[model samples]
Target: MSTVIELAPGVRAGFTGRDGGVSREPYATLNLGGHVGDDPEAVAENRRRAARGFGLDPRDVVWMNQVHGADAVTVTGSGPAGDVDAVVTTVPGLALAVLVADCLPVLVADAEAGVVGAAHSGRPGMAAGVVASLVAEMERHGARPERCAALLGPVVCGRCYEVPEELQEEVARSVPEARCTTDAGTPGVDIRAGVTAQLKRLGVTNVTHDARCTRESTDLFSYRRDATTGRFAGYIWKA
Candidate 1:
């Protein structure tokens, strides 16, 4: 059930599920993230397999230690993973990857600019202006927001992601059109909608979203559904 979305002609990205990795239960198969307390060997093997799906070498992926911040780093040659929320690059054969469970995985590409980006968009980061920062960072590398196309991958829906009243107020204060509460009078936060609105505000050309919810789908790993479960990845690159 890991669905892949092709945004532009030569740029492709997808969210992987737990069906293809080598981990056992708890971390159960196909877990691609290494910092999730899964076995190192098993995680490494899983990453290798997932990398191959993009016709890329496993070592070519530049992973990041996401801190739910607004910083987006640019990678040139393969080195080490940095502490950031997003990554953009024009380098060929290097995949910009983001690991997520309930957090939104955002795939972006400017086909004409030969630029591709991947971002882990959670409430804190999105509220802190991660999407806008990402667009700006890409622009620094010659990618224009009006020419950018975005794909929002699987994430927890608002109905399942209830929050506190103060948190909702804070999100609303920061993001326009953010769903601060549900119809049942429960406080909630919709990270996906916040990101969508932000993209629209930035004048992004296309924004695509999938209906799948990681917490609701048994095919994908869910952090909130199962606290100790493994992590899945969303990746994109230019070929």
Candidate 2:
């Protein structure tokens, strides 16, 4: 079953629950991103299906060329940026969409303030402070830090997502609390844990996690889980 986490009554967000649309083999079905070697037509149709599922205007959903950096753009209009890792908007009906494979697609909203934001938190971007950057921009739009709630969408959980020692060291240096190792001697970084601690430090009101491990679950698209795979999206919009 597809799951959508409700941070508050008016805020709605979820990962693209698999098992629908048209794609093949590596992509299988319900692959929403076009850049992953899927058929363009199939990708377009998949996106259309997602729009219909979310009850959103397909054209109004904003996207960005993710560079895995800490650049968050504030959307005062429709259209996207060239090198943005996150998007925040106070405008209604404009859904902020982030395409992710194993990376965390973070959704944030201030229901009462009519503000919503989405961030692409891969290794580099999370290390560079993408989520924090987005939260800062959301505050600029009149969303109080203590009133905005965040949802860490489906991603590669620490257990299934392993990393090299150097990379783990880098994560620890960038954000000290990012390391989460298991008793079996598997060393890795937990993006959710790191980001959650950062959010708390920023005074974010509420932060809830979807708890779906993309790499471990075949239901969600994961590049790490399936070497070459489709991108399932996690998006949010102000209504």
Per-residue lDDT over 44-135 for candidate 2, one digit per residue giving the tens place of the 0 to 100 score: 88888887788778888888889899988888776765589989887777888889988988898988888899999988888999988998
Task: Write the residue-wise lDDT of candidate 1 on 1-239 in tens digits.
Answer: 24446688788777788887789989989887777788999998888988886567888988999988989888886645588998888998788888889999998999899898888898898889988888888988899888999999888888788888888889889895676565567998888889999999998959998778888898888888999988888888887
**lDDT, candidate 2, residue 22?**
89
Give all TM-scores, in the order shown. 0.95, 0.94
Model 2 misplaced stretches (Cα beyond 4 Å): 1-5, 182-184
Name every residue pair that clashes in candidate 1.
21-30
| Candidate of highest TM-score | 1
lDDT of each: 0.85, 0.83
Winner by lDDT: 1
Q: How big is the positional error of residue 72 in model 1, measured in Å on the Cα after superposition?
A: 0.9
